[model samples]
Target: MAGVSLYSSPSFSVLCLAQKQKLHFSVSGDNQNVPFLSRSLASLRLNSSANPLPVCKPFVTRFSDSGSSVAESEPDSSVIKSELQSETLVSEPVKQEPKREELFAVVMVGSRQYIVFPGRFIYTQRLKGANVKDKIILNKVLLVGSKTSTWIGKPVVTNAAVHAVVEDQLLDDKVIVFKYKKKKHYRRKIGHRQPITRLRILSIAGYEDYPAVALSDIEPIK
Candidate 1:
């Protein structure tokens, strides 16, 4: 029939299995010895065998490569213990370097001004009869700054004094001055060096509102 299918025949599976690899298919049957039917039958019989594959085996997986590498590269237990000990060091806050106070004082000495700091020296115009290591009080504080506060004076603060010790008495380098009058043919040459004193600031004291240190309940022997 025109609507007939080859797969509907009884030998479909057998022929498929036989020719699965080659992908070739054909069929024939006797129908009153027709020439076309005879040729089809001969072709079908010529390529009837199949080459289908057999059933597959079960699946399996293993990680021996990764496991073997890890095993081979492991450190000794003692090394591991030491590393663990190092990592377990006591945790503490980061200790930063101590910050210096930004304290300074502006004091006047011999008609000159200076900004002095604790334990630092400043040069001033020569002080009469001042000797090295002689203690002196600077009573002309114009301004004073502490770590957290500043005090200013209208002209000069009262009672604020800086204690200092004379460190040196020295002269500045000589400076030369030349005066000339070309038409009058007159010339004057002069050289001068000024005297200066080096004083090391010891401390600044005044109404700083510092915490009062408690006096001993009993006075100590002088």
Candidate 2:
């Protein structure tokens, strides 16, 4: 068979022009061009494996309140994680503080004694001449108590007083009275509400100098 060479063929030159591409061809006449094709393919492979073209990656652009702009790459993992953690902390609910209890005392208002605390309100038997917004000084303190200590009066604590203001003059819930007599066919019913005065305890004074007993020092009842 005649040795037909592809080295000088026009098609061979066209194949070489295609850089970084696969090449397929059928050589039926002879194998004389095999060495040349192998050498050309090897050279093409080496050229394809050269350093790749420079890639243009996207960037993040930020604008400040002053109209200044800056470009930056993607945020670091640690920075992004910290931002998420800060958001979670901000989204959480805030805790509320516990309310502190204030001082309280027992005092006699009229014929009856009553227990009262500062900043609290209570209803008592109506005073004949007392009007709403009238300030009353109750000087019959029997016991003064606080979180730290307590003071007890023999009958009434001297120099101790409970200050209160009349908040309202109102009537209490109705009380029903019923009378029945068997076989006499007599029955009577009546409903009535007692008049009462609402007083807001303002302050308990004159017991702060007294000695106090710590709660831990007291033993529980057996």
Candidate 3:
């Protein structure tokens, strides 16, 4: 028992005993007691005498005819199709036009200079007497640039002018100002909003003679 494995022991050797018993049963022809497996092919033949599975038929739409043309055509398919088409058109997003290169000018509105283009809006320091819808022509154009050519002035372009209309005079966002003195314990906090004017650029003149760039010919910025 010290050197032998558990399976090799006669008391634990169940497989050997079963095999010996099977061989002894086979020699004695006692197959019924041994219970050997008997395999028979399954019957795959379906019953022709039984009712067949129900067959599904294609669905068919029926329209009623009441002898009146107006009543019969009220629920027409064409009307439904047109309604669906209209719904689809309403749901579809509007296609935006592609952006094209336009003439731009660098003009000085007040002490600060701004780059302006036609139909675009800009916010500048409040014009003193400018009112809403009042057109103002800016003559201090430092540079005018386009796709084909550029015009740069020494101090300011003479003929170059930018026309803009005052859209609104509004106050800008508040800026918090805080003053502090460490030793004296003096603290002051205040907020200020600078008055600004909104201007819609109507046109940039003097550069209309330059060639306009086509949408496809515009080069991508590197």
How do the candidates rank by lDDT, highest first?
Answer: 2, 3, 1
Model 3 lDDT per residue over 97-182, tens place: 98866678899877898999888999999999999999999999888887766776777766778989999999999999999999
Report the Cα lDDT for residue 43, model 1: 59
User: Global lDDT of each model?
Assistant: 0.77, 0.80, 0.79
Following a full C-alpha superposition, what root-mean-square deviation does model 3 have from the true structure?
20.4
Sort by TM-score, top down from the best: 2, 3, 1
The 10 consecutive residues of candidate 3 with the worst lDDT sum are 37-46
RMSD of model 2, in Å? 13.6
Query: In model 3, which regions exceed 4 Å deviation?
Result: 1-101, 208-222
Q: For candidate 2, give the lDDT of residue 179.
A: 96
Better model by lDDT, 1 or 2? Answer: 2
Local error of candidate 3 at residue 176 (angstroms)? 0.4
What's model 1's overall lDDT?
Answer: 0.77
- The residue pairs found clashing in candidate 3 are none
Query: Which candidate has the top score in TM-score?
Result: 2
User: Quick one: best lDDT, which candidate?
Assistant: 2
